[model samples]
Target chain A: MDINILLVDDEADFVETMVKRFGIRKMPIDSAKSGQEALTSLAAKDYDVIILDVRMPGMDGLETLKLIRARAPLTEVIMLTGHASLEAGMQGMNMGAYDYVLKPADFDDLLDKVRKAFERKQLNAKARKQGA
Target chain B: MPRPANRAPEPASDPHGDPKGILARATGARLWKDHSLLLWAHFLVPPVLAALVVAATFATPILAGILAAIVLGIAAVSARGLLSRLSQTEEARLALNTQLIQSQKLAAIGELSAGIAHEINNPIAIIAQEAEWAAHLIGEAEKGCSADFAEVKDSLREVRAQVDRCKNITHKLLDFARKREPVLQDVDVVRIIEDMARLVDKEASYKNVTLVRSLPQDLPKLRTDAPLLRQVVLNLMTNALHAVDTGGRIEVSALADDEALEICIKDNGCGIAPENIDKIFNPFFTTKPPGQGTGLGLSMCHTLVDGMKGKISVASKPGQGAAFTVRLPRRV
Candidate 1:
């Protein structure tokens, strides 16, 4: 698979490292510094999965998630947060994020979740097609 | 799995058997297994004793009378036993019927509330927007007016806040009512639980509560809807955190068997009262004072677990603590 992935975070260093890590795996990933920018990117291209940082400067992850879901209902979102805030995690999952991973997440674990999320998107798409 | 619409109908092996006939056969098999001896005695003993009674009547009246009395006594005893057994079965069926009716009522109420929530949401949104617009107009007028409109702005802010509160309740109601089909995927059960537990770690620490995880290392991966499971675990953990007092303890554990995977959240806190236990999972059922809780968390958990073809239950003793268990099938 050719998976279209987007990484949204405000931290420059975190975004840079993720881009490089995914690049080494032969998977080119898009990056966004804020939720607004993520929405812009989403409008331009259809993405299968999104790795979103919870705490951001402009639009928070949960708010961004609501919009992303509205814009692209099939896209899967995985929330990443630096701090373990119980409230945000609850809200994120309730709002339809695929999974929630804390900062310092194991690279392999994150990759596994991403793959699973992509698989769900494919299944959902196929299901919708059949339903239609 | 293949779509139901595309699948072929199953073949019935018996050419003469329709669906009803197959059902009757199944019931008959079960009845035979359970009461075969009773049936044999009931059919055979009566005829055999009647023949002996007739023979005795032909020979002597006294012996025939004795035999007839014995037969009558046995029949009376068996009739009494069967009557008691039938009454017991009737009582059990009545209880089950009540339960079924209660659940059906709950489902109907759930649907009605969801419809009300949906119909109310738009007006709530409009109210919030009008509040905002009114505040803006007041702000624009305040600039040109000589008098202070401070109190008016304050009231507008209050209206907006109250509107937001209504919005929150309606949104939760909508969530409770939404029919989300579970999307199955390969899920690492341990990883998902650990991730959600980490989210609760900081809050747990603040309350001096220890969140112990006893997840087994050999637990199997589950095929389930990942986010729905995540929501259930997170809500339950959060509920536990609220239940515990300072320096309290909460334990999160996961167990897997061949058939199902079980995750439990146990808390040492004020347990539910016996009177309130049955009402806990009902929507809008809350023990917390007004404005403290919306009471949708556990009910939402119930709804989500049901969507995933799983079961959720609670066991609690007042003054001791409470434990909630969520059991998911190995494959949904």
Candidate 2:
């Protein structure tokens, strides 16, 4: 699968590490350190999946997801957070996020979610193309 | 992270028009029900007796005088004792209520700290994983007989060790917030100090500060919580870093005597002020600007050390830097 993923978080070290790890796996991945940067990256290129952190300085994950869906409805978003708040998770889902994952998440689980989200995105794109 | 943007305005939903009016109305009702007769008699009795005395003085002077004295004596003594005792009891209840409020506040703070710890753990995990990956790469490079292999290996080891320290900090913060009991074990202060020195070496150099270690070879292992002890040392080291500027020096030394082990962190930077010395270990007391410090570092250190039956002290003056010494009992 040709998966283009965008990882958004405030932690630079985490972004660098994940970028390197994804690179080693031969995946095309990009990183943004804040929500504004993430939105800019989203506008510039088409991504199959976005892994976004919920808590950020400005333009939180939920807000960014809202704008992304409006701008590029085909893109799938998987929310990530260190602290687990059920209300936040539910609100993110309500706001059209594909799924929510907690921090220090098992690599296998996160990869599973990302792959599923990408597959869903591809399906939606194909459906839209057929409709056109 | 961010302060509350806007507070929602409260609504006026009181059934009663005003709180004070409601209180007064309730008090008035109770007063009328409980003591209306006594209150009315209190005012009427003296005047009625005086009128009786004046009228009876013309008839029987002895009877009127005795009646007046008895009524005055009973009114004076009865209410005085009851009022004083009631006020004393109220005062005691108020003090107990204040104490209850304080404990509740502490409990709330504990829960907040736990939430913060969870947030911090994610970044620590990332840093740790990155360090691990770097270590793997370094191990591979070492196989190629690289000239800089030794230095790279040492630096990677330091990074990994410090990441572990960061992990411990998050764990300890959660445990402390949950009020969990510490797990005691034999901890070597020498090794702890060495790891901490390595951890802060990069930061120290970045600020052009000299880092020194002075652990003697003959120190004994101390019994305590390893992570908590590491946290204390880490907090002290980080504080020392902020206390100094360029060309400043920090020395970490450990010594063991017959009964206890002493680890001292000395710095040649800006020392704490005399007034702040006493409040240095207080929660939320910080000299650094908002967002720079949580102000919990030293207070948490103080709590952990005290939990281990240890003592931590500081000695310093303005412009002369400070030294923090932690004394823990030595274990065989």
Candidate 3:
């Protein structure tokens, strides 16, 4: 029931609104204002899921996913997009985002995708430990 | 607004460059420059030759007459040749001009369609949704009256169909003008037609243009891009729709013949001028206002038809409106 999550997005309103929504749903969460802040958070702490938005100005979603995969290879990042752009979604997937959701998104789908990502990350961790 | 009587500047200066200019010039030029010189040369040359051939013939009076006859024959042949050359040159120029105009129209249509699709997409969706809600309320209220429900359903379907038609027409207009390959497939004509109808249904409705269709029982299919054919049908129907006045009827029908299937869109709008009839298929010719029409619709249709080894023709009378015929080779 306890799921640690990092939400990184430049749109303060969207980030705050989603934070409130997740709080109501009782999901453990940390919020970051930018990609660098998200990286710093990951370095300092651990999270099960990272929800990122695609169209951030300087450090966009794809770049964030790249850095996240490099730094926290085990953690899963889900891309949240504003417009349903086919190109951005494919790029996000290619860059190793767990799953992509369109904005004004279905919260249930977001939850389902995050839950699967968490389960996958756990399996990956166990596999690494056994290999070690 | 009063129509400007002299919008074209006395119709001269560029008189040498209308689509009909070459033909007019060849036939209408004041005098043949070479004719006078040739006439004088003929009179002089024949006498010298005749004198050389026969001193007796030269002395006879018919030599001068013979030379004059020869000059007349030459002029007739030269005039014939000039007329033929003028027509050919005009046709060639027209073909080039058509391609240019068609390309421009396609570009403009694409830009407009994409913009309209994005801008009006929300409103169209909302209108459709609101229309749905009204339809629903009617259904609910009239459940007790079976006849009322039946009538309501029928009318709502009409409204729904109309909305979708506008959507299709606009989308088709846009895509036709965009001129991209747009990924072809073995598209079902029914769906494409419905899509186009929906796009333009709103426009048609506002214009008081009634759309009536007679699709074939089982029309032949084609291996073509959906977007492209949608463009072709869209252009024809939109043109026909615009031509017709409010309360006028537009008959859009699709049929099949040997190795070919066709769509003929007929409108009860003001028809083409007899002089402009043939020129309509040429480039940059439109009955619509300058900004309203790029005059590429028919040309694009021709280019598309030609590409498919198909053909398009128009039948019209001055006051009776026009019918556009589109025939495409049936794909096996």
Candidate 4:
């Protein structure tokens, strides 16, 4: 399966830049502006992993994480936060997030985290198939 | 504003300065005695001075000079005693102010705890869902599947949930730590004051300070930030009640005069010293001793009132009682 991923954030320039970077590397990337939109995309498409931003105007990242866990348990979520509060990072980890990477994120670090989250999702899917 | 619950240092039972806790308790009695002594000496001295003058006029100069020395000695002794008594009164006032500071700090911590509870609740729900999903998914997996993946999922989810709970509570505790924000707002004075009084009433029930509202029903609203205004009202009312003996009364009233809305909270407490009337609103200035006050309540109030593009003034004469008047711009 092509490794599918969703990058959700409100910053247009940041999103476009990341999309271009991913495109150059031929990495699969889909993006959304808010938590609600991210959820809608997940419902229609089966992404292996998701990258979510915590602080947004509406339906913040934490709330989005809860909805995602409830509706699409198999998809792993990697949190992206511009504000580096240890408490937020800790909470993200506690909510079964693959990991929360801080911004201005080292693109290489995010890619590494994204790869790990995809592998975790793949493992879960394989287990589910075998169990079924 | 919410305050951190745990950050409130426990009732500093052994406050650094004094563990014995007795300073100027007999201030009134001492002052009365000093004044009585002064009166007696004044009465006795006048008669003696008259006798000395008469003696001098009648050619008994030596007798008159001896009388003059005695009168001067009496005046010096009484003056020293009065000054000492006054200093003691000043020290006692300082202690009461300290107690007020401690109370404000504890209040701040309680506010923080409430905010922390709100922050933690969501992550806990997510953690639970993730664990349940992992559990059932693993249960349905192949009998010979890699147990390592299963172990990682279970351990990580458990670790994450516990950490999230702690972080949520701590973050809230920090966020809600209430302190004086020098920011002012255009507030609806009548509404804000009433809201504050209502909160104080619920809390005052435990202290038994009877809260009386004497507000003009149709007074124009004032321009003030609701949150800061609410806090200033709360601190003053709470401070008044603390000084008021149980079964004492606190009156909260609002009125308007031309361009300003005037709100007053009057309490029949221990009252304030004439010297202290100016110091009460100074930061860290309190009449209540350590562990009871942070000395910031009135200071915070003073700052809030001033920042609102208005004025806050207090009127009191020791023993007659104290009244705080706050004026804010009338909302159009």
Query: Pick by TM-score: which candidate is best?
Result: 1
In candidate 4, position A81 carries an lDDT of 78
Worst 10 residues of 2 chain B by lDDT: B2-11
Worst 10 residues of 3 chain A by lDDT: A86-95
* Model 2 C-alpha lDDT per residue in residues B1-332, reported as the tens digit of each score: 62222212222332223544433343333322366687777677766777776787788879878877876775576568447645654564565445345434444554565667778888888888888888888788778884667787788789888777666556545544543234455566786676456556767788899989988977877776654666677678888988899999999998878978889999999899999986787666799996566576677776667657677889999999999999886652
In model 4, which regions exceed 4 Å deviation? A1-132, B1-186
In candidate 1, what are the lDDT values of residues B15-55, reduced to their tens digit? 22353344434333333347679867866776678788899
Question: Could you list the CA RMSD of all candidates, in the order they appear?
Answer: 6.5, 21.0, 20.2, 19.9
Q: Pick by lDDT: which candidate is best?
A: 1
Q: What TM-score does chain B of candidate 2 reach?
A: 0.49
lDDT tens per residue, model 4, B1-332: 33343344434442323433334342444344446876687568766776776777577778767777766776677677757767777776676567546445444434444455556655766766776776667666735675556565668667667766555444433433433222323345665566456546645677677999987778765545544565567667777777788778899998888867887989887789988875776655777776455465576566456445456778887765789988776642
The true-versus-predicted C-alpha distance at residue A52 of model 4, in Å, is 25
Model 4 lDDT at residue B197: 65
RMSD of candidate 2 to true structure, Å: 21.0
A9-126, model 4: which lDDT tens digit per residue?
A: 9999999999998888789599999999999999899888889999988999988987897798788888887765434543454455666566787888678667756766666677
**What TM-score fits each model?**
0.85, 0.38, 0.36, 0.35
- Colliding residue pairs in candidate 1: none
The whole-model C-alpha lDDT of candidate 1 against the native structure comes to 0.85
Report the candidate with higher TM-score, 1 versus 2. Answer: 1
Candidate 2 residue runs with Cα over 4 Å from true position: A1-132, B1-175
Which window of ten consecutive residues has the lowest lDDT sum in model 4 chain B?
Answer: B175-184
